[model samples]
Target: MNEVRHFWLGISCLIFKVSKTFRYVDTDNELEKQVGGYEHIVVRCPIKIVDENIVETVQKLPRGTIPGDFLDAIVVGMDMLIKKFGSSNKGKTHLCLITDAQYPIKEPYEGTKEDQVDIISQQMKAHGMKLDCIITIGKLSKAINQKILAENDHLLSQFSRKGVAKMRHVGTPTSLLGALRTRTISSVAIFKDEKVVQGSSEERLL
Candidate 1:
């Protein structure tokens, strides 16, 4: 758990350095229960990144006491982004999902996990929000679900040809750091042209 939390904090700080706006959501099952339900995906911080305090706040976020459903979390995140930047052509908008692919879809979901992924991908396409994923490997557990990981990789590849999504599978903390740094530095150029272009670092991952 510490490994996962620290990796995420490092990514958040790196993003804070390069991004003008940042928002965070914790999909922890315990948190969801306390907040009333999974539907209430809380934004731990505001949309605007004012200063270093945002980084500090993110750093202090609690580690998940229980596993969370990434699919449900993705749905809520997509809805928030769609509401906030509906069809706007102003700035680049993206949702980066960092996970270990441990938790699969649980009960109470509207449809099958594949169906949810399809819906989420379509919503991302319609809203014009890029979906980037940093899928950490071997950090959480040895029993990581291969099925979920494969499904997630497929979803990550859904819009890669169009530069709508990018994914990195990192097996160590050092690699994770390098991936996040590379992403933060290259994101603007990647999204500015609306296509990753040939020979780019992101394209090599596809």
Candidate 2:
């Protein structure tokens, strides 16, 4: 019998959805079928943040900030996945990062954006993981900003320079599903940057 491939999937969404749309659920189900035979761990982005200080705890997180600290969230999710799934001997675990931000990351604390990207890229290379970023354009077609596209392109270029493949531009669930079914992808750790990073950028096709 042929050995099944393995994958670690992590998905992140900026806008809190009060309800999952038809396409959203359909895309998730389709992705499950596509990876049915593989040993895979699926995780959603923005792992819960809990602040504990002796006598108090906080779970609520504020939103609507420039270049939100989303990379940190992604890393948290990836770490959980890694801990659950044993190391892969294949030299590379697959990661799929789904995001809707056009500019979602920046350089780590005391580091430049380029430095942060390089560090994350190197770390993934060390861990034998490959990443594929799926970006979802804004739902508001009328108010879509040009800066968003520019930022999105820059992000894709940065990842490509670091050796990721099939960085795709998707606007809807159908497009996302089409890309996932046709391409192979993975993800890397999100590092903390010195300042809020900005850029412009996802999907559920698969």
Candidate 3:
């Protein structure tokens, strides 16, 4: 049974493992706490934001900011913010992005919910914490014919090394956003309700 009432005690955000490796290894995770219902996802974007005035003050430099150099500043800033949280009991921790902003040309692991659970669950156990979830905004496109694409045909077969990720075509205005609330790509967490269907951003609102 789902415990709806257990989720009412507000939320505290934890930021750890700012080592830019996406793996949380440090002993300290108390980063920041907010008095909300975990409505927003804390995304430590890989891109660093700089003040325009700071850049304008650098008169001696021949060139402006180097390409992708801002990412370092963001990483440092996020670490500092994480340090501020200071080991308090944050409700649920979700890893946004701990690496470069741009998607890797090749992904190290399948970015599925189940895959994420397995990979990060170990880290959570290491920290004596249970990570509720980590959400990253990215899209994937697929076209497959199960009958045509079969075994023993290397030239004609193309498959995700992680196997064909089960997908359900969710239609309507808030379909994509609503599906996220379920957290499981293969589960039915909501039902239709007139003009207002469930939203993928429901967690954000919760």
> lDDT of each structure?
0.44, 0.37, 0.22
- Candidate 3: C-alpha lDDT: 0.22
Better of 1 and 3 by TM-score: 1
RMSD of each: 9.0, 16.2, 17.1
> Best to worst by lDDT, what's the order?
1, 2, 3
Q: Count the backbone clashes (under 3 Å) in each candidate.
A: 0, 22, 8
Summarize candidate 2's per-residue lDDT along 148-169 as a digit string, tens digits.
Answer: 5476467555767888534666
Per-residue lDDT of 51-122 in model 3, one digit per residue for the tens?
222112222112211111111212222333334333332322222221112221222235743343344334
79-122 per-residue lDDT for model 1 (tens digits)? 44444446552234555556665544455446665565666676
lDDT of 3 at 154: 22
Better of 1 and 3 by lDDT: 1
Which pairs of residues have clashing backbones in candidate 1?
A: none
Poorest 10 consecutive residues of model 2 by lDDT? 191-200
Candidate whose lDDT is highest: 1
The lowest-lDDT stretch of 10 consecutive residues in candidate 3 is 1-10
